[model samples]
Target: MLKHEKKQYKKVVLAYSGGLDTSTIVPWLKENYGCEVVCFVADVGQEREDLDGIEDKAKASGATKCIVKDLREEFVRDYVYETFKTGAIYEGDYMLGTAIARPVIAKAMVACALEEGADAIAHGATGKGNDQVRFESAVAALAPQLDVIAPWRIWDMQSREELLAYLNERNIPCKTTLKKIYSRDANVLHISTEGGELENTWNPASENVWVWTTDPLKAPDTPETVEITVEKGVVTKINGKDMTPFESISFLNEIGARHGVGRVDITENRLVGMKSRGCYETPGGTIIYKALRAIEQLVLDKNTRLYREHLAIDFAQLVYDGRWFTRLREIMMAAADEIAKDVNGKVVVRLYKGNIDVIQKDSPNSLFNFDFVTFGADQVYDQKDAEGFIRLYSLPSRIRALNEQQRKQ
Candidate 1:
């Protein structure tokens, strides 16, 4: 298909997810490349149903062996927490659930390949999507010598139907059907749905498109309050119980989903220069984000908050563009980690029908001093000194106004 000639590889490691695309890829790689295929499944806290019997499925589809890595704690602790510290939200809504999972998955895939003595690594990401770049870029950054195989870019098959037909022709069983064709990516942080009726901008996302969260309209009328403790910008406890990073997110996800706290439908610009509409459900991530920001309101000062905001924009783009292993990412994250030092506090939030409100916040480093500005006469700040301070603050504007008046005279 593509103009490049196929080269021989002794063995190849595939980043497998037990999904339609990946299930098909396992056999396709063996047939097309004539190499031993080892499936590498990274467990980033996806639904258990999606993972059940995955090893058997991979073996039945022709993989020599399937390696499952439990990266739940690592994913939440290292990748998710670090990103949250920077407060990066892609296009203002996406919590970077899928984007953040890519590098970790790719990193594990590379290690698996190296350990398996494979000369190449493969992924099922399509050429049209951001994941293709995310997967390949991480491979390039981590292990430059290993050849990367992207079947979608090189194969003749184009549609989901074609992929199903290819698998059927070979008598390989696949669960995907024409009726249910929504492409989904899931992790502990969130689940994202695309394709099917979502391709058309006018078509509304059906109820079926949402898999994790309750419908806001159907949600309970009563509001639920959640308290979270933050240390260095990471959620360390939920309510009163201390939890690991993964446990913390899991606890919030259960509570947030019931109240329909995080559901977003947005058309985002892909790295390949195209706009794609998708619906994302990020219940736990939304709660954590709100709680962290509420704490920041108490802790960070004016200039530092502004700096973090600017850093968030760049950090978001960096993560979206798959530059995780680069020095720039390290540098930017260093700044975020620095800002996180004072982001220690507790926040109480109320979740009601898809809305989150920060009801209370407290931090040891809070800059909000009640004594500084109070209508009941505070001794901490001098009211008479405001005249001189205001004059100096507006000196440039006053000078320009005086010049204008003189010119008019």
Candidate 2:
């Protein structure tokens, strides 16, 4: 048996998902540790219709009470906006949807624990996953005094099969079984699916598995164009229409999902030193990245853009590796924010069958000079100026070659 430490906690708050792992945890806490478990769930825009019976489900699974809080607006404004401002994309592909949300969700759980006077807070994150690190690290940063419990790390039940048997032996009702299940996490920003048939990258994802997006083949052939405007590093409008942060993102997610805009299937390296295959849906996020990059071209200067890009890769890696609460991450985000001060502009994009096309862009800070760049007769840029500019640009290489020739002679 895993020993409960000398630190005794009476009221325990659990990060509940209404999944098999979390469902079993409520009872396990009661049985193993003999404590009152208060289930806490954060609604971060995961299709709420699917989560209809979750409150009752948590209550039935040995939880003393359940708290489901709506965090959709806060999630978008705080986490999503911060990520957008940083321009951090993990491995140059993923938008870090799941990774970014972990900190905010874990923070909210800790706040709830403190409010309820719980001595310890618990999570259903598995030992093999990145979420465990994210949850633990945030707790260590925000509420270090509180005890943390991760049942998956301590429990002897190893696999999904073992978990099912553990529940069955105790006559516990579980939605998942030994043979049929896919591990899934859904939020308003996206839906992620792993395990089951997704473990094999060679296998084709069935249409039934995709719940949020329309199939590209079935999507309308006509392309739709949208204009996104950013002010003070935040997305302020879509299609020339001003909207609240929640309204704009929700509007675009629907529009983009119809065109199959954000579907990524990859075997990414996890924080725990393992490769896990997953399919992520990030409809509006894709559009945001595309539009934001176009705006960056209009506003960000060459050196600032290049240096910020260097920081972007490392910043992305830190977030992906679950180091969001660290000092390095804070420093990088600060740099990114300063670099983003001038990244305010309008970007028009066309969506057609999984592609985001930047149509037009403009900003008050734009450096693009139409008078100098135009092919027509222009006085500002003389044709002869290119010869001297090219020679000056290549001077280092020319000197190196001349020295090498002299040495050879």
Candidate 3:
């Protein structure tokens, strides 16, 4: 009788970033799976130096082909703007830097795999972090038939030490060293840092944790007020200059970073039911978020704003947990779009020493009524009308107090 043969994945497309983890993964997949590995690099606005010579590095690491695509416009316009409209801020701190970028990268990887006629996809996300769930969930949703090979789960080689040694044995070169202190992920919206000194909750983040922003204490003494204009929840102009979404964010990132506009160090709850510490720099995103919120306050009515706040909390959690590809996020974002339809306005934001303050805001759709709000004798509102209104409004509270008095008696 012939022996049973286990089918092998003939080819695998890897989501490659040319980073410490991914650089090693290219070789690891080839040796372990006995498959031709194709590298797919998505440029979503990381530092240009990161992408330089990436193709050569992939080929040197044994990849059959390397594909790099720029997704900056789509990333900012579709994902970042959509999330901004929802006012989604994870745990009131993180801007969902790593979380939001994953879906775009994963979607591109799947497309590359299909184009290359590959049977499997692989990623270098560690077993401990949220990226694994994000990458696999996206692949599962987009291409269920394609096999997902999460090396961190199946591989016996654990730790940075082992990864380095594995590459050493194969004579593969990498830029990372054992002295590397932080594990970072960067893109257009923000840059995030984890591991190293951040694991200790009580210890304050040192200067080494910072990348883009100047130290708040060392920031320029002069305050720079930036004016932004929003049309339907999207920033259209910065300081009277009309720009595309990509140009707007890029410009803000430069100026905001100069003044240390966005920096947050917090212990946040991860989607996998654990607490983790991270430091993030989201200079441009902070300005954009503040400006859009100012527009919301100007244009959104009282009840609509209240409901949108509730929706935003839920949306933040959904985005943080990597549910962007789901219908729940789609419906919520659709509702957010409706809520922000009238969010057309201009805002003046004051940026100084890591602080962002909205100094002035005006909107064509503003519900603010000068006649109703004036302390002076107002023709539109009567002071006597408040007596009846307050009575009806406080009826439930009045009943509760009376009931308490009766019980005491």
Q: Which one is best on TM-score?
A: 1
Off by over 4 Å in 2: 1-7, 168-172
User: What TM-score number comes out for model 2?
Assistant: 0.94
Q: How many backbone clashes does candidate 1 have?
A: 0
* CA lDDT, candidate 2, residue 279: 82
Q: Write model 1 residue lDDT over 104-166, tens digit each, in one string.
A: 999988988999999999988888899999989999999999999998889888877888988
lDDT of 2 by residue, 272-345 (tens): 88888888889998888888888888788789889878887887888787787789878887887887788888
- lDDT tens string, model 3, 1-409? 1123224679999999887778888887786778999999999999999899999999988999899999998899988988899888988888888888888888888998999999999988777778888888889889999999877777777678988998888889888888878988899899899888898988889999999999988999999999999998999999999999989999999989999989999999987788899999999999999999888987888899999888889988887777788999879988999988999989999989888989999999998889889999878899999999999999999999999999999
Of 1 and 3, the candidate ahead on TM-score is 1
Every candidate's CA RMSD:
1.3, 2.0, 2.8
Error of 2 at 198 (Å): 2.2
The parts of candidate 3 lying over 4 Å away from their true place are 1-7, 404-409
TM-score for all models, in order of appearance: 0.97, 0.94, 0.96
Off by over 4 Å in 1: 1-3
The window of 10 residues in a row where model 1 has the poorest summed lDDT is 1-10
TM-score, candidate 1, is 0.97
The true-versus-predicted C-alpha distance at residue 271 of model 2, in Å, is 1.4
RMSD score of candidate 1 (Å): 1.3
lDDT of the candidates, in the order given: 0.92, 0.84, 0.89
Backbone N/Cα/C clashes per model? 0, 1, 0
Candidate 1 vs candidate 2: which has greater TM-score? 1
Clashing pairs in 3: none
